[model samples]
Target: MEPMRRTVWGMLAALFLATAVTVTGCSVTTEDPSYIPPAPLPPLEQLEKAPLADPKNFSSGGDVLSFITADRTISCSLTSARGEHVNLPYEQNGYSDAANNKLPIVPVAHCGLVTYQPPQPGDVKDDCAGTHLGYLGGVALLAPDTARYGECRSGVTPMEAAYGPGGTKAGPLTQLTVLADGQNLERNGLRCSAYNGGVACGNVSAGVGFFISPERYELVPAPAISSASPQAEGPKTP
Candidate 1:
């Protein structure tokens, strides 16, 4: 009976020991060798607005004339001869003014040498009636409002000489100067003036010249100075 009891206790102890070992072996723990968390993104900010200029006081100088073909969609800035900063984005009705009523956007007529006819001194006023402005051989000619015979002379010879063989190309112009009432000014060897309701330009010596007005724009042949053919000369005093 004692031997049997001892054998039973020994069997129970061995079973418990085996059970403990199996439980310990079955349980497992593992750590990842290459796992990492993602980094956070940077914060965003709102953009600032551009500063604006005063519309009422924006009419700064330099003949602030707009071209007849000026594109309103294209924004730009220009300085006038008066040294004023005129912003084009703010301009309305072609004129960059508060009232926007001063300057008129009239179509400009660009005429070449072949199409132009030199006006006889006596018929200048009548011939240039509907004309606005004209250019020949790279020289800018103005139509006369009145036939001032002696005043109508070729301003091209001097201009062609000053600005090279073909005269200065008009492609580089950005702004046209508004001649003060009856004012005449010289620039780049050419003199421009407003006369008898017509705007005109010529060689300093009054040799070759052109005239035009707001209502008229034609590239008439610049009047010849002398009855004889024009001499290839530099600017002379008008």
Candidate 2:
């Protein structure tokens, strides 16, 4: 009887161990609490196919073109290196060419939102000192060559102000042409589309760009494209 009891206990222990091992192996895993996934890329294909904006909606000065959305909530300046160098407001102060000097003349698409929530503390870099960390308005810069697409310390409000005539931040708003919805502007390898949500701009060659609105902003990095993949073609200027 004692031997039989010992065998029974041993079998029960083995079964318990096996069950425990099976449960451990099949346990569900959870994502790391500290891990944050990247935002999804915008519909680049759709934006690329948008119809061209009316010429009257955009004002071109040689290589630089300036336009505002129909709602006047967002404005953009697209600059190409082809023509004479145009001094852009964001390029004037608090920006360094060292980060973007690789190309002889890189195309740039810079946009500003009239109203936007400031970036979170983690998103705000320590580069800006004394001045407020983030501003009520948000700005995005897409220099495809450098893969740069994000907000900088130089507030967009100041840029908007400078957009006024005579380089004054208080310059009249008439300087910027209005881009209606479902229309896009393409120039200097850069393209911008205005939608009901906001504006999307990108460097067609590099496959990088940004989407900005009053609620939030997203930076698009160049996607890895296999040779077999169909590329999104950049729009031509009208």
The prediction achieving the highest TM-score against the true structure is 2
TM-score of each: 0.22, 0.57
Model 2 lDDT per residue over 166-235, tens place: 4454443446777877778887667888874788887766767778887877667787667886779999
RMSD of 2: 18.1
lDDT of candidate 1 over 1-238, digit per residue (tens):
9999999999999999889989888665687778775542110000011122232232324432222111111111222211121233223223345554444332121111211234433344432234533322221222221112211233543212323345443322223223233333332333343334444444423234444332433333444546677778998898
Scored by lDDT, the top model is 2
lDDT of 2 at 178: 78
The clash number for model 1 is 29
lDDT of model 2 at position 166: 40
Q: How many clashing pairs per prediction, in order?
A: 29, 3
Inter-residue clash pairs, candidate 2: 161-169, 162-169, 164-171
